[model samples]
Target: MNARTADKLATGMFWAGALTVIALLLFLIGYILYHGAKVIDWHFLTSPPTNIAAGGGIGPQIFNSFYLLVLSMLITVPIGLLAGIYMAEYAKNGPLVKIIRTCIETLASLPSIVVGLFGLIIFVNMTGWGYSILAGAFALSVINLPFIVRVTEESITGVQKEYKEGSLALGATKWQTIVKVLLPTAFPGLITGFVISAGRIFGEAAALLYTAGMSSPNLNFSRWLPTYPTSPFNPFRPGETLAVHIWKVNSESLIPDVRAVADGSAAVLIIVVLLFNILARWIGRRMQKRMG
Candidate 1:
């Protein structure tokens, strides 16, 4: 075929594929929202799950999900960023670096179920934390770290070399340059990856199942101590995240409106994830503009 004809055909194929993907995503999202949106309301969101009645909410589970998210990100973000910096900026190209990369790649390839089992062994059984939000957060950290590290490292590395050189020429220390210039410039990528990874974490179920347990106590929002079973700060308390709540309601719950509860929770979870993405994108763009 002539060059122009071949190019036209390729463009047409690309459009076809893109359109197909958009259509599929829309259909999936629409189906989920349609079934779940009506069931969600203030009462449903603010109350606890019920046993016999069909009128409970996912209050505790929702809190647990966000609680666990904060805990996991707290562990992942700084550690991941530092590790990434070491790998990309300071680590010499050597066997040790290769080994680190190899291990990271291998960990990234492991399935969530396998990671869950591993978390069960160490975070639950060995650590004696049992099934708790803290354990779940750690499990999630294991699942999320590689992504964060990969993103941070690649983002930092992707920063233009001249930027670093200019900063150095301006009498800035290596650390100063990294902290002030490299990180800010790469903030957009880092934040995007963070939100994407968080979206995955927010929807995670299997790992949390083994680590965080399948039930959350009726938490006392006023209580702020680990000594209290219902305290929000009691990370040791067993808790069910939103994803696990949905899974349990769908599969094993004996509640009258299990399907309804599951649908509502799923919708909430999806919407929360979407909101996180949007928020992150906005922050990333704002940061990018500021940096520029």
Candidate 2:
């Protein structure tokens, strides 16, 4: 074939591939919305689940998801960020750095079900947390830690070396250079990592199941609080996440409109994840503009 013809064909092939991906994504999203829309309402979101009706809302499950998300982020972000900073700034080219990097990569690729099994053994069985919010959060943090570390490390590494050199050349110490210049430049990436981790934690079910048992319609705020001294050590407190609830409704519940409830929960989960991604992208862009 002529070079010109060949080039046109290649370009067309690329466009075709891109369009196919977009079309597939649109189809999946349309299917979910079509099935879920009728069940998405304030009442469905706020009310407790009922065995008699298939249309009962998932208020407790929603709350549990957010609660676990917050707790996991709180535990994972600081430690992961610090590890990243240490690897990028202090341990460059060292054996320790290589080991740390290898560990992070391995953890990132580890199966979610395996992590869940570990949580089941360690947090729920060994430590006696017993399928509570704390146990679930710990499990999620373990899964999220590597993402935060790798993202933070890459973000820090991406900060222009010239900026660090210039800061040091101006009589600034290494710590000052990192804290003032490098960190500010990498803030967008760190935020992006955090958002991604949050989305993952939100959708996670397998790991949570072993650590946080699937229980629904139990939204007692007192059970979640540490201030309640009279609360029992209810580790098997039957905490249900939105994802788990969907699975349960679809697989176990014989309710009449079970399909609608399952689809609606899935849609809500997807929307929440998407919102987090959009917010992260927006924040990253703003940070880039500010840095520029």
Candidate 3:
């Protein structure tokens, strides 16, 4: 084929692939909404699960999911960002740095179930923290750390070298230049990584099942509070996360309406994830504009 014809064919194929992906995503979303929207209500969202026959709401589970997400992010972001900065700015392509990079890449690719098993062994069995929110958060942080590190490192590395050099020439120290110039420039990408990690942590079920035991929904602030008189240090408190609730309702329940409940929960979970993604993109764009 002539050069112009070849270019046209390549463009056609690229557009075709892109459209196919978009169509597939739309189809999946439409299917979930069609099946799930019927079951969603205030009661469905707020009520606790009842006997397997009567479908109950998932308010507690949703709350637990958010709780875990926030806790994990709190633990993972700072550690990951600092590590990323160290690797990007200070660590040359030396032996120790190469080994650490390899380890991060391998951890990122590891299976979720394997990570779950590890959590079960270390957090549940070894540490005796039982199945509490803290254990679940720890497990999630472990799963999310590699992604955060990789993203932060890449983002920091992408900052313009000239900016760093200029800062140094202006009598700024290495740490000052990094903190003031490089980190701000890379903030958008770092936020993008955080959003991705949040989505993954929200949907996580397996690891949480082991670390955060399966329990009925409860929002007893007195029991959960650290200083409350009734508060017990029960690490084995089976807190039901939203994802696990869906799985249990679908797989273990004999109720005819269980499928509807599961679909509704899945839809809500997807909606929450999409919101996080959109927020991340918006923040990234805003930061980019401000930096420019």
Highest TM-score: give the candidate number: 1
- lDDT values of the candidates? 0.90, 0.83, 0.83
In model 3, which runs have C-alpha deviations exceeding 4 angstroms? 51-54, 222-224, 227-236, 254-256
List model 1 lDDT by residue over 44-163, tens digit each: 887887622674788888888989999999999999999999998899989999999998999899899898999999999999999999999999999899999999999999999999
Over 213-283, each residue of candidate 3 has an lDDT whose tens digit, in order, gives 67743456557665443243333455779988888877888656777889999999888888888888998
Candidate 3, poorest ten consecutive residues by summed lDDT: 227-236
Tell me the spans in candidate 1 whose CA falls farther than 4 Å from its real position.
none
Clashing residue pairs in candidate 3 are 44-57, 131-235, 215-238
Backbone clashes in model 2, listed as residue pairs: 130-235
lDDT score for residue 109 of model 3? 86
Clashes of each: 0, 1, 3
Residue lDDT tens for model 2, 1-292: 9999999999999999999999999999888888888789887898778622666788878987887788889999999999889888888687877788889888888898899999889989898767677888888888999988889889999988999999999999999998999999899888887988899899998888788778743455566454443232233354788988888888886666888889999999888988988988998888888889
Inter-residue clash pairs, candidate 1: none
